[model samples]
Target chain A: MSGPTVLLTDAAPAKAASTRRSALLGGGGRALLGLLLPLLLAGAWEIAVASGFATGRLLPPPSRIGAALWSLAASGELWTHVAATLIRVGLGFAFGAGAGILFGALTATLPPLRWLLDPSLQALRAVPSLAWVPLFILWFGILETPKVALIAVGVFFPVYVGVAGAIASVDRKLVEVGRIFRLSPLALARRILLPAVLPATLTALRTGLGLGFLFVVAAELMGASEGLGYLLVDGQQFSKPDQILAAIISFAVVGKLADTALVTLTSPLVRWQDTARETL
Target chain B: MLSLQSLSKTYADGTRALEAIDLAVPNAEIVALIGGSGCGKTTLLRLVAGLDRPSAGRIALDGEPITGPHPGVGLVFQEPRLLPWLDVAANVGFGVSDLPRRERAERVAHALERVGLAEHAGRWPRELSGGQQQRVSIARAFVANPRVLLLDEPFSALDAFTRKDLHRHLLALWEEVRPTVLIVTHDVSEAVALADRAIVMRPKPGRLDESVALPLRRPRDPAAPASEAATRTILGALDRSLRPRDAARTPELAGGSSF
Candidate 1:
């Protein structure tokens, strides 16, 4: 027995050391590769505008958008709109994701609750999220309350779906392992259910956050406001194509940045995952 | 002692998985269960583990009945069933979570070292090979100091060499704690090498067919003549179990033999 064990230890660490991928095309390299095509397209659009190939009207080029953004930054106008949108999204996400996990866990563990809630929730899912806008404005008085509520509603469904689905799909075999250990229900949930559901839950949160941005546009559209959505409306009312393009570009960049930040923060939670994401 | 009294199981769909089975496994004895598919060997193991209900009979550990999983009993499945989110040490420590921190850590460390996994404690389960993962599960089972261990083909997925290696490791661990063990396996040599007796079963409504005692001494070599003879005897019993006529006719013949 000792002989075999000794042989195994000797062989395993060597294999582990060799499994490391070459450093040349690592994580940084892949990120840079992802940025390549978008940078090329943006450069091409900028040049097309600069060399007099197009009027650069109605469709402002990258340089004009950048200038618009730069002026907004210098005059401190961009900060106010950006701050409002971020706060609404942050608050809505906290509320929505929190309730999602709570109810998701409840419905998953209790069949009675699932039978009672799942059908109505699914029906509610079909109602266009924006359909709540007019009613919400009338109800909440065209304030931050309505906007945040709308964003929270947008963020809720996916997270709820994710939590319930993740819990339902957790491997029964692993649960048996918990049972064999005589784990208490609370300990079983903490030790097994929580970790098992984490990966999918984080994914759902990303989906919810993305929807938060989408609903923020609808929310700001409901009434007078300071936000990126307000910039979209403002640019259109004033007929400033440059500002509209700038706001649109800001939406894309800010959304991507927020998603990136989320993935970075939660990556450590699922670091034990043996998926392709870790390898590439 | 771990005992089953007239254990029987019938599923909801009108299938009799096990019927009228009686068994008594004394303390510190290792019993290997061998049978064809649907023989209810795994079903019997599950009953004893308290993971399922026995329709006709009850399982007892010592003098008390087992209604649910007990801290005194530990089970290992065909797959590792490890908590992939946890590292090796944490997985081993999971069963003893109620213990004092110092005692739990000490037991986990000792079990890991016993199973040749002390060096791999910090590593995630995904980083391990199939054999190593099984070893970690074995360590997890022992960490709680279980009095009876149930193994459901724990090494069935490994290669021949790895399986043989694991048999040795498992025996070594068994020798230390001497827990009453019930192992379900298709491998005849495994029965000869590890079990004190091999219980063969008949299928459909699975019942104990023959009990072949392997009186061979500890650290039995698979290639030795005594071990080969024991293996052949268990294989013969397994072969006879496939036919109803052969089994019903020879009720008392294989029950008394030892190699």
Candidate 2:
């Protein structure tokens, strides 16, 4: 009995190790598959341009787009535009998200404050960000303020709703637990409310950032001399298809990277919740 | 000591949960309130814990009227109710915020050690099994060192093996800390196995029916004749309380009722 039990135990870990190794290989294979379609498309585009089936001026080849990107990088124009957009997005996101969280906390916790400000905020939220653009440009006179404010307005509503709703729906039983332990109001907010609403709030922030990117493009299209949006307009004016494609590609890559960064930064805080969901 | 006098509770919609319930628990005594569902055992416990206010009556702790959540009272709910974000040590230390940092850590450690969960102190609540989470809740309650501890069916959710183990653990803790304990449970054997006195309650107005004193020694074997006898006595009282209502509904069956 002892010998057979020892053999079975030894066999179990070896089986587990093989399954883990296969899982890693499986992930890598899927990633390679994801790249296949894009590479094939690029190849087809290059072939079409080379064969003169598709004109280079209308739909630029992948090589032309690559050359355009290289020229921009060499001139240092790419870095300045990218940096400007990043700074605007960063500043606007901080301002809008900070105010959203504060207002959400107040409205969710206090009935009087909710009654006073919630309706007005809801009404304002219904107004489109574009509708604010002309008014913003008039009020702020094409300065950085109107552009930044547009992005902030775009980022504000989702975060506000997420935080307020999350706080409102916190488990009553857990709040009772806090009360039973004689937790002060501030202590309860810090320990219970904040942790409970964190996952939802982070999701809202991700969505808000995506919207921020869209608004930045719209803002830059108005009167901006720099940023990726300017490049798109400039390319359109000059009929440079390569430059337009480059701008669009940069947007996709940067948006993806920002979302990935947010997830990586917040994953540790929500690991317990994720594990609970998985087990369930 | 904990005392309740003529405690009654009627909901806003006119559902009477408990009526004129009177009881006195001496300090360091272990008492169990046993009843079927809707028998006001939990209502009584909640009133004592000051989680709900009595419609008409008073509860006092050592002659002081209980108003809100009192510092000397601790409660363990049916579910563990441990915060998922906090690890075991943090949950255990939750109620000891008034203490200095070092003292709070020591208290949390001591409580976890008592429940045999010191090794799991760094793990999240989700990482632990159901029994372990309940133990963390117990550790949380005991860490505060309250004068009166109220448990509302704390072990009814566990499996038999785990429930038996927790019963022993609870008794051992009671022996050490010696807080006045009021446990509300529906399990008759649990009542007989743990409490020095069991208060049997009945539904339809939810009043106390009888109190059975268990003279069995500590470290009781539930299968022992004495423990079995106590269980039978409490079950018999519950049966009697339940019989009259059934008899009233069906007159024909009441004539030959064996119960």
Candidate with top TM-score is 1
lDDT of residue B110 for candidate 2: 87
Model 2 ranges with Cα > 4 A deviation: A1-21, A275-280, B244-259
List per-prediction Cα lDDT, in the order shown. Answer: 0.89, 0.87
Supply the TM-score of chain A against the true chain A for every candidate structure: 0.85, 0.89
lDDT (Cα, tens digit) per residue for candidate 2, span A188-218: 9898988999988888888888988998899
> Model 2 in CAPRI terms: which quality?
medium
**Weakest ten-residue segment in model 1 chain B by summed lDDT:** B247-256
Candidate 2 residue lDDT tens string, B188-213: 98888888788878797888766788
The top-ranked prediction according to DockQ is 1
DockQ of each: 0.72, 0.66
> Which numbered prediction scores highest in lDDT against the true structure?
1
Least accurate 10 contiguous residues by lDDT in model 2 chain A: A271-280
Candidate 1: clashing residue pairs, number:
0
Instruction: For model 1, name the residue pairs that clash.
Output: none
Q: Give the DockQ (C-alpha) for candidate 2.
A: 0.66
Model 1 chain A, TM-score vs. native? 0.85
lDDT string for model 1 (B165-240, tens) is: 8898898889889899999988888888899989888899888887899888877888999888888888888888
